[model samples]
Target: MVGWVDRANSKRAHTLAQIPHEWIDPNVINEMKERGYVNTREYLDSVLPQNEVRITALTATELIERIRTRKLTSFEVCYAFCHRAALVHQILNCCMEIFFDDALNKARELDNHLVTTGKVLGPLHGLPFSLKDQVNLPGIDTTIGYISRVGHKAVKRSLLAKVLENAGAVFFVKTTVPTAMLASETVSSLHGRTLNALNLNFSSGGSSGGEGSLIGARGSPLGVGTDIGGSIRIPAAFQGLYGLRPSHGRIPYMDVTNSYEGQELIPSVIGPMGSSIQDLELFAKLVIDSESWNYDPQLVALPWREVPHVKKDKLRFGLMVSDKLVMPHPPVLRALMETCEALRRCGHEIVEWNFPHNKRMIDVGEQVYAADFYDEVQEILETTGEPISEYMKIARENISYKGHSGRALGVSQWWEISREIRSLKEQFLEYWEKTRDLTSDGKPIDAIICPAWPSAGFRDGDVEFGCENYTVPFNVLDYSCVVLPVTQVDSAKDIPDASHSPFSTEDKKIHEYYKPEMFSGMPVCVQVVCKRLEEEKALAIAAVIEGCLANVEKL
Candidate 1:
């Protein structure tokens, strides 16, 4: 019988072996080692062949449009992204499974179909995409970074995978997730830690860390990630990518394995992590247009709404700079302020808002997330005599940082928690509607713009570095949110508030860790959140915010 160590090493070896030696550039590897901060896409351009970089750099929309016009072949786009993914995995340890040969073959078939039938496969025809580790593909291991599940192969494709494949999307790699997919940092005893490619010393953010790092570095054009408590938004924000955290059942979660699978109170939701808001909308539209709800009864029967003007140009946005628990680092605050100013300059309304239910939300989240006391996680580790990851341990241990126990809450206990959360949801909804009175058109603010994390990206192994107070409330309410990349850390302008005192121990720990020099140039973003099941409106506002940020960059 293979022990956990051998099993883990074997899995890592298999992933590395999948990348051809020709794709490995030792010089680039050496350059990365010598440096800490790198503009990953820019660095790749200097090291990789111009044609490959050019093709890999194209967004999913551009790649498909070019392939449709015959300006580029599906084969070329697939090979380009697969190669870039290879290099990125070698550098960042983001990829867990790589199937380049299969992807290339599919790409060739797609090109031939276009030639013979003069028709593309579907909306996403010939576009290359990546997957989060838990998403199943037949014959692939969906261990999701657990050694015990290493050799077990998935016999069927996840429903989401099938939907995308049928739409002409080619998949070549599966990204990483933390143990039990619970940690904000992606580190597993099976595949090791996924580092931020932008700054090798910083965390990539998880459990979608692999998807974030790969897409952030331009290794994959678009990817799908699951979010329960900011899993999608955290990595997307840390790596400076646009991500969607849809309301439960908005996207099919059936056929995918997850922690506490039966827990539907704040069940994990899947959404897109991509280069642009358009790609997120595209992925959502394609999946929903197929009426995926028919295949997965858990899905919402919400069809894609074509709202050319979902909201007015003069929008009202609730600005949340701090959660009153963990204040953001200087760069993050700068990014939030910059975004606020940019929106205001565009004639949009900005109103400062504070959260009164965050502490309650955090406590409920802890009770729900760790209610089982990690029994499943401990059992999985014991099976192979594998030690639990340090990040996971630290995260679980910190559940009491708020002076509450996360022990198993029996059905009745959780029922009360669920009931409390639902009531809070009603109260929050009331607050949302009351904001309409604060608006010129008597409509609630289009979305709430706020910082995603305390820092741009925490240092590697800095798992206990930040609080999820800002992100947890939305998950508690099941609101649709999108991460909007605004700016990167600037050492010159972002200095610490050394004179400020801490509000709590968690605040002190997070505050003490902020160093302009350490996190310099790291990507910083703010999440744009809309009401429940309002993804179209969220994305629309997010696009506007994205545009405002772009204009800020121009200045």
Candidate 2:
């Protein structure tokens, strides 16, 4: 990989230097105005009164119940969601494209089906869901952050979209992603930046940022997003939503636009995001139980297992105070401490486990993330003569700073590293298995708790030294991980303890940014991680933690 890197670097010298600085072509902007794609100000003025229905953030199950009982028509539900989503896009720049008319028409048909047949189409019938732009929809442009793809459209819908459509879930709009879907902050030449809904000044987190902002704002009840690095989980964490970066292959990835098309050493997974965990589970089961594998051959055929019957009293958990790579920010640290305390008070055994080699896992994750030389990314950008967006350029530099030795491992070194990674997996599992003998019930931990990211959401462009490895390492191990927002940054309590001093310059910088004033009110989250393919167990554990927090709030 290193050798290829030096060769690739010598192969090109900041070619983005030649491109113009503006976001889009003036002609394209003019053409958009001519085609009625102008600013939302004029449109919203005429369309404001029509936005009468504003639905609260309800779960799919609740929405389905309402639709079935005739309290809410399918058309009304879809329309309400579309109207709010358009308003969200206007403020946050979330949607890459909107299809309110088509979505409302589908909702009408679904309502008629329910009325005539006296039966809903599926569990998700009439519920509105959003998608990350990479997921294709027939006849809808899927410009996954490329200028040239502005008018691009797919001939067929992606398997995920098709599955949702068949299940009667209405999609009114597709959200934006960073160019190449590589950056943590969402911005693209095609649609510009997607800001956080909670505080427009802060990042929503990406490449699923737009979806995060939309869901965070209650514009949509549920959304589908793809995760490579911290794509789904990061945004979900930032926006205080529940997001699952399921084990790779558990969900289909077929037909999605990828930053690295064929680099398969570390694979990306598509997963559900929503305002609540139950909704996350509902969507997860709805899609998986639909036997999605039949359509997307790449998807694992694993059906959603029934919720495991596990008693909290009998359950054991492993807890890590820190990954020991980059320490989490003070607010994040406080949340972890609070969570551990809450779980302990709940009568669950919490065993401390630390893995020193975690930084190595993070290293390997990054190596694989950029393994493609980003060839496909540059090619995609060049296609439209679109200047690489600031986010992508920044991402490329961050990846470059890892200092590729300008050396590639021989076939033998590659095998050695692969073997080492496999060995590490077993080693980690061994540590886990040993917990069974020492824990209260002599049972292995049901799940392990850890920080989702170093901080709630770092300042834009502040990811020069990426801490995404905290989440991405799970991706490498294919561990099932879920992000749960447990607490908000409390200016009074989340203050930094700089007296201890920094371990490195970067560590100091990380610490320095934890000023209560800067991070106040950002959602501080934790991740529930379980062994590979143990999503059911992981989610159950997440629920346990969530319950503990709720109980504490009651007190």
Candidate 3:
């Protein structure tokens, strides 16, 4: 006896009564099914090993060894990873798109090539990898979380993708990001939010949050992430994985999509992320050594060098446990203390480092980053009709409304600010050089140990969280930074000292927001940083820290 309008309203009310409706529109579901990917179970079974096989935690190195020894075929390895990636996406919302068919097909081709040639196609042959939604893969959509770009596929591959494909690496999937790819957390109108693997209630750091979550869950052996600010390092640290924001120009950026289409003063760099330093080194060495410069003119001509020069007995290090602007949370503080103690036990000299000029660096970087007034960024948002992500709302407060400043600054102001930044960089470098005279053997400090952020994996939509500038300072200096997981958060010890005072209003908010129970079991990490163009040395130092901590963990 109900009228049609009344029945329609009843259905609508019922839908809203539950958790947000995840309706797969009939047209979209049909398209997915037609492509043979809507139900991943059958495809996964045909291409992957069974669930009981214990293939989840294997590193890229171990997988390659298994493939080399003929204990596992390339097809089987790729299959296991694709299946795992599908499962991870289901739970974490980490994947932007799945490409099992292409990856499996590529794996079979690698197997045949190995049989005929008696040699692997390249270092990463048959390795399954995921890319940040921003990186372009040929014939795959790189919408970057915007509905406007949803069906727009790349005509050519990104430099990194091309390099990996040429190395016979199987690119199975791409992951999600914020709408403009500028937020501190990943959530988009297109693919939705990516959740933390350790706890679903927390955020995976963005704009590479999906990559961070996917790689952290062991869904992909490795991934490619880009950073201009703390994009790559923050996510990796939150996820307890290794990530690098190499010196500008270290990795080529051709065919990649970005919010700042033409802003070049502080150009973003593409880098690799993995669960271990060894895996990171493998990807970096193979990709750079492939001479990708021939395809991307922007790439520096630096070849990857497996340098053997981390002398543990003679290394001197500067430690920045807390930035003046924001004191790190108790867990991060404990990790720094633990790391310092471990280094001292290993005979490495540590020098106290307190940087007061960190604020200026943050200010300058913010100005330069927002110099275009966010014109291109605003345009992208307007085109997609998606609301700004929360992290970006904070950045917009510092930049302009509508998400950017469209006006240009006077030439004189621009020139003066540029000089100020140059002076700051020179001053930092000088301060670092002075450490050489303080060293036992008069050698410059090999690297600096600093907190990657103020805290580990924050609760979802934590806009008031501050202290991310720790990683941003290195980016301002144009130096390379590698994130290494130091320990796991323990609620019993990481509780807040409510009786103590805060450094600032933002600092207080961040401090008061800490709930030990909420963040328990999340990984605590730090940044290992070196001068520009010292990637090889920086990574080697990171490896030393990783090895040192691993040794401590065993005891």
Best by lDDT: 1
Model 2: per-residue lDDT, tens digit, 196-312?
Answer: 767655787988988898888777889988888889999999888899988876777778877667666678888998877788877777778878788776677787886657434
lDDT of each: 0.86, 0.75, 0.76
Backbone clash total for model 2 is 5
The estimated TM-scores of all candidates read 0.96, 0.87, 0.88
Q: Give the per-residue lDDT digits (tens) of candidate 3, residues 53-103.
A: 356567887777777767778898887777667666665778776777778
- Report the error of model 2 at residue 549, Å: 1.4
The superposed Cα distance between candidate 1 and the true structure at residue 502, in angstroms, equals: 2.1
**Ten-residue region with minimum lDDT total, candidate 3:** 15-24
Deviating ranges (above 4 Å) for candidate 3: 1-53, 400-410
Better of 1 and 3 by lDDT: 1
Q: What lDDT score is found at residue 182 in candidate 2?
A: 85
| Comparison by TM-score, 1 against 3, better one | 1
What is the model-wide C-alpha lDDT for candidate 1?
A: 0.86
Rank ordering of all candidates by TM-score, starting from the highest:
1, 3, 2
